[model samples]
Target: IRAHHADLAKLLTSVKGVGPTTASTLLAQLPELGKLNRKQITALVGLAPMNRDSGTLRGQRHIFGGRADVRRVLFVAALVGTRFNPVLKAFYARLLAAGEPKKVALVACMHKLLVILNAIARSKSPWSNEIATVV
Candidate 1:
């Protein structure tokens, strides 16, 4: 994979917690990785939150309807990222500190991870702490 798609492989694997399988899944399953904007990419991956409001009753926001296979891979990556990736770790901590549920915080991290990856891919650059933080 590296020999054939060296640039992409490097870019995808630059982030912590993103291993061979995650990179491979992104490259193979999400061909539109770099081609789309942040919102577009997240929606495509089903990480974008969907509204669930009805009349005066406000329902809990939920994410649904996108690439399940990609979402599954991202879920694992995000879980690992919360522990290993500095940006994600900090973000997750902040969310939890703000009283967000574990599951909610993790899903937010997943969305963030995907956005960071999307930005890196779009910029055609390898991951960097500074860049990740900025994104």
Candidate 2:
């Protein structure tokens, strides 16, 4: 991958939690990562929350129906991110403090991590704590 997609590999691995395997998986499985908007990217990876409400019934928003493989890779990445990535670590803590369940917060962190990666890819930039925080 580095021989062919050096730029992408470098960009993806710039993030603290995204190792070579995670970056490669993303590059292979989610070719649209940099090309799409945040919403599109999240939906593609099954990280976007879907509304379950009906005409007269309010329901919780849940995620479903996207690339399970990408989602699985992101789950592992997010777990590491919560501990090592300062931005993600803070985000996870904040979510937990706000009463979100551990799993829910982790999912949210995954969503956020994807968004940050998408932004980085789109801008052709490497990850930085300041830039990631803004994203």
Error of 2 at 77 (Å): 0.4
Model 2 ranges off by over 4 Å: 1-4
Q: Per-prediction RMSD in angstroms?
A: 1.7, 1.4
Q: For model 1, what is the C-alpha lDDT against the true structure? A: 0.90
Write candidate 2's Cα lDDT for 1-135 as tens digits.
556477888898999889998898999999898899899899988899999999999899999999999899899999999999999999999999999999999999999999999998888889887778787
lDDT of 1 by residue, 9-120 (tens): 7888889989889988898899899889889999998889999998998998899999999899889999999999999999999999999999999999999999899888
lDDT of 2: 0.91
**Candidates' lDDT values, in order?**
0.90, 0.91
Residue pairs with colliding backbones in model 2 are none
